[model samples]
Target: MDGDCKTAVVTGGTGEIGFAIAHKLLCNKGKKVVLIGNDTKKGSEVVDSLNCSFGRSKATFYKCDITNREEVEGTMKKAKNDLDEIDIVVNAAGVWNDVCWPNEMETNLGGTINVVLSARNHIKKGNGVVINLTGLSALEPFPNSPLFASFGAGVIHFTRSFGHDVNFRRFGVRVVALCLGITKTNLHVDLDKKMLTKEMGKGMSDFLKNACYQKPDACACAVAELVKYGPPGSVWVVEGSRLFYYDVPDYKECLNLVSQFM
Candidate 1:
């Protein structure tokens, strides 16, 4: 591995899933991680913990809002200046909002765009990987979380499209989406309880209640594997402990699949 391969920038690094991924990167990949998040207190705590586990100066924190493009760009520049070129970028800053769809879209989809655009140039010259954290809702929408599903679907499509961006390809950067299924993360803390409960109904609620949720660490392990194995324009899905390449067929293929019914 190259000397520069040990540096990474992770958005939403204060969150449970993001922090887990950072931990995996540090322990398994031997990467120095710079965490970006809005919560200064939590970010500091996470960085301190990571540094303690890894080594002093191996982990750092940069407080920034991913929804703000300027803040994201500035953070990226500072990270690059401080840690040299970034080998990997993990976009884990997202929200599942049903009360306010527009805000949710801005945070989840727009924030992803801001991070990708800002970090595209600074990614390592070759073999740099960008992992956008999406959800199974992207492929299979849930009733109560329409906005969240929409954001994930948008992110999956955009990740593929952006993988073909001239600058991204020129830098040999690979962009892909990681579709996680029912991970135990803090994504639903701000959910509208009444709206979610009512929208989900009894069956959905029961299903969710009985469903087996993958732990943050388990999901993080799958994400780490995808970071190394996922090709440009691809999407990888993980359910429980099973991970597989997700194939999103084109419209023509869909039409063909339905031709018999027509």
Candidate 2:
């Protein structure tokens, strides 16, 4: 490992966006990437693949559930020991399962609280980066998605407001939320086509299938760029195959642009 290669921890790293971000970090900038996820077997596989693909940068997978505050603290401690000084944290740990209990808040909201609280010190120590991902459902309300809507909305508000920017400024950390429209990922594959059609109404299925969604690998690359340059509270929206950048000041302006498309 290069002494200067910044260490980045990515939650849900076995998934497409997470894996793509790790791969891009390793292959593009030789960043030491540590993947955190519950699926030890698949997560280890991603680590192996990155090792083979980019022998320059080091990659490893640690089994930790971000929802567990203890596990998050333990993982952060171990990762700090391994890397010396943590630089970036990608809070990608999320679950869409709203049909069963209150797992949505427990997993999504709890995981974020853990990730931010665990890495609080690192952000204070040096110029750190945090990227939280949200979805279009965040901006709009859906009828049947009673579960995910609130969580998505919470993520958006947390990343945009909720003292996140104040902390970034106070501690020299860069925390931003990337609002993704729709992407190609295994999670989408799990959704029943019929269910989507039923939930989104009839024509929505075709609209989704033909949507010009960005690939996971590409979004990952963009995230690495964000880590390098994007500022705090900057909401990045990648939609219809075009990457758009919007800050709070110009949000009204950007919102107007969005209205144009709508």
* Candidate 1 lDDT, 97-135, residue by residue in tens: 556667788889999999998888787767788889888
Using all chains and alpha carbons, the TM-scores for the candidates as numbered come to 0.90, 0.83
- Candidate 1 is scored at a TM of 0.90
The TM-score of predicted model 2 comes to 0.83
- Kindly give the number of clashing pairs for every candidate: 0, 0
For model 1, the run of ten residues with the poorest summed lDDT: 188-197
Write the residue-wise lDDT of candidate 2 on 127-156 in tens digits.
Answer: 677888777677677554545767877877
Q: Identify the leading candidate in terms of TM-score.
A: 1
The lDDT of each candidate is: 0.81, 0.73
